[model samples]
Target: MKRFQKAAGQWLPKMAKLRGVTAAVVASVALSGCGVVNHMVYKTTGDVLQGFSRNHTVPYLLNTDDLAMGCAMSEATTPLLMSFGRVTNEPDQIAVMLYLSAAGCADEQAREHELTGLAALGDMDGDAAEDAMIRQKRAHALAAKRYFRSWQHHNAYYGEPGTGECPDFDDDLDEFIYMAGLLSGLQALNAEIQSTSAIGVPKNVGSMVGRATSCLDNEKWWGAPMALRATIWAMIPGAMPEGENAFERLEMSDRQGEQAGVRLSHVFHAISAMNKGDNERLRDVIRRHAESIEETPSNEDWAFVDAMSTQLIVAISDRMWVENNGHRTPLGQLGTFWDDEQEDVETMDLDDLL
Candidate 1:
């Protein structure tokens, strides 16, 4: 009996120790695998969700006013500012530091500089506007624009490219530059209209300004160039007949030419609001317009819708720093637009956008 007891005691202790060691090893393995599992999930889901190709085309519809939201108050003012240069160094670093300082984003620094420079340029208080001051103002604005573009580029890359993924250049910025250029050209024309007496200004300058201004002012549903109206209506579907889907209304109008116009307007406004950092308004407008369209069961126009919606979202979010200003800020403390609600209710996906 003593012999049996000794053997049993010895076996029990050894077994217990072995079990403890095995448990420790198992726990260690599981802890190590946790990281691998996490990585796999991130790769499969996160990457797949945002894997869209970088679309780099300018949205066709946004007008100069919308484009200038990032650079100046109106389309008319963009050139006056761009005559100054853009700021373009260490944009990401500048933006983050500015954010940390609670000083707004770096993208806006250019616009602010341009504005102050312009205000300083004419010395709005000066007895007469000197050529040197005008040149200085233009120089400052140009510098600011460069910085604005750099900041925008950096921010876009920071969000999507960090994943070692696709290049995500913003189309809205390109459009803004394009629109700014057009407006600058217009301003020169306007200047000649006022001061250039040595030679008569080209009639085309007067005609272009008149047309561009008309594009900005007209609000009629049927009378204006259908392209402009349709484009505007697309971006802010809320502007359409209250109950009907703007797209459907356009489709039913069977006026393809007009419908195209409305689409162009929508694109332009979406691009404009984007540069201005007006996300709430941008989202609200898209949501309203999206409600009216008949989404398809199969072979949906999802690509186009998704591309436009994504561009709208990205554009607004990209320049969020500009939204918190006196002139650009919404009407009410909790407001969206300067005068009236200007957008529609249609949404697009970031992944599928053009």
Candidate 2:
């Protein structure tokens, strides 16, 4: 009995150590299994969100004519949608649109502040004008940042611009996204210039975007590619091809945009005109845009794009009106100006009716 008891004591510590090691192994495996399950869940959820956003949400948004709503949606949902990149591949394609829309919101705000600054200058309120200018700069900086983000995502999706070859687009949507990216790059540069600060926008973006436009077919895209190239030519000194006329090309592109019911080229035309300080040409572009929208129904599949063009045109008109009249364009009166002559009307005297 004494020998048996002594042997049990000797073996007891080993048994306890064995049990402890076994428990650790089981716990380790269980923790690993939980980790695996968690990863799978996250990956699946990310995939679903990415797919649904690209397949349904994007298409629906593109069809809607509500620019304000779209801007709000982009502002509200960009973070949530972008977070899925942690678990899945980044939705760079959708990111381009979201950032572009968000940038537009900022750009619009900047324009408003600019108008306020102009009004203050007119009132001779130096302090107020200075404050408005500061605010406008801040908004323009924000716009530049957002537009640069869009350009980055476009690079991620399309393997960078000015690569001397176009990406093999899967569909028209892919091509559109590519174009949006090009627009974003150009906008980033423009916004940075407006902010009068180095917002890390590539200085070469103007030339790069100009070269990239060659990838797209000029006629099929409603002359937007050429319009973009021509705008770059007009903005950047010595960028135009020898013997080519940027303004002439812009006029031709404008006609194509008007006929195609897209009218994007008008925005470029107005920008170029405004850059050159040609108010008459700018006003004519705005008037033509107002008339074109009324005359041509927006292409059904691309109504949202057409509406966006109109939104930009309206913004330009508001700036012009505010500068001249201290107010925005009147509702349903976008084409008319304060300086426009009153049309003659046949007036019947009330006494004659009586």
Candidate 3:
């Protein structure tokens, strides 16, 4: 609690200076409004404040691909940012939800960097390898932390199944932000669990995530909501209900995202395939991504997000190449296999290594 207070104190000054307002002042305003009206206002304000966090924080952090920046941005924005949710009077629930969702998204990149770094450390010195391992463990740990935190908040806003404390969004932005949080959080949680050293993945996580964000309309969220649902379906055994088609839903999301011009749903499918250890499916998705890039060269909105997603896919390709042949993916390997037409490059394999 003391630590929380101290950290909150530091940001309070900046919050006042930049926004010319303080959460304490907002907290004092509860005396003047009806309970319901005040609750909506608080949640709406918190929802708006998170945009500033996403805008001012995410681009710079993604460009440099820095882990510290991801954590720093989380700390820097969350305190004063939570105040918006606080003022809204939803038991500080929305504030908690906003903070975790944004932080979890930021941490997703951190986890990916660690995964790639582990692969990149191949053939390094003992000391350097140990250091890389240390960093990777910590990175996964942070990723797990943010994801679980988001999970807790999701439960808070909407209680466990059959016990209804449902979330009602204020607008499109509100719903999008909420679902984005769930998407990132669930993905992060999966990565953390795979790391086997991640802290705090829920034991009942499968059930928790299976039914999460059920309120999201597919077309409304540009297929992201379904993409997330498909991910949980594909990754968790028996999680998909009888007669439900996970792949079809994933493909549906892919089409919707492509039509929406966001294309993030593909990333979800690719990541899911990777998790399931279906190399053929992974390759298929990667090929599709490359072909898509070939067809539509530029992504005007979410350029960096889409680029980073591709980078991770490339990192996966790099892993395959490293394990198969002694290097990262060949420069021309994506969308096309290296062994197909590139005669100069030997079609190396296990036989060559053995």
Q: By TM-score, who's the top model here? A: 2
Residue pairs with backbone overlap in model 3: 42-88
- TM-score, every prediction: 0.26, 0.94, 0.64
Task: Supply candidate 3's per-residue lDDT for 350.
Answer: 84
lDDT of 3 by residue, 123-188 (tens): 555566566556666656665766666656655654543235447777654565456556545655
Residue 269, model 3: lDDT of: 86
lDDT by candidate, in order shown: 0.36, 0.91, 0.63
lDDT of 1 by residue, 146-220 (tens): 333433433343432112432332443422332233233333333333232222323343233223323222332
Q: Which number leads on lDDT? A: 2
Candidate 2 lDDT over residue span 293-312, tens digit each: 98998877777888999988
Candidate number with the higher TM-score (2 or 3):
2
Worst 10-residue lDDT window for candidate 3 reads: 89-98
Backbone clashes, candidate 2: 0
Candidate 3 residue spans exceeding 4 A from truth: 1-76, 79-130, 157-166, 297-308, 325-333, 343-354
How large is the C-alpha RMSD of every model relative to the true structure? 21.6, 1.8, 15.0
Give the per-residue Cα lDDT of candidate 3 at 325.
60
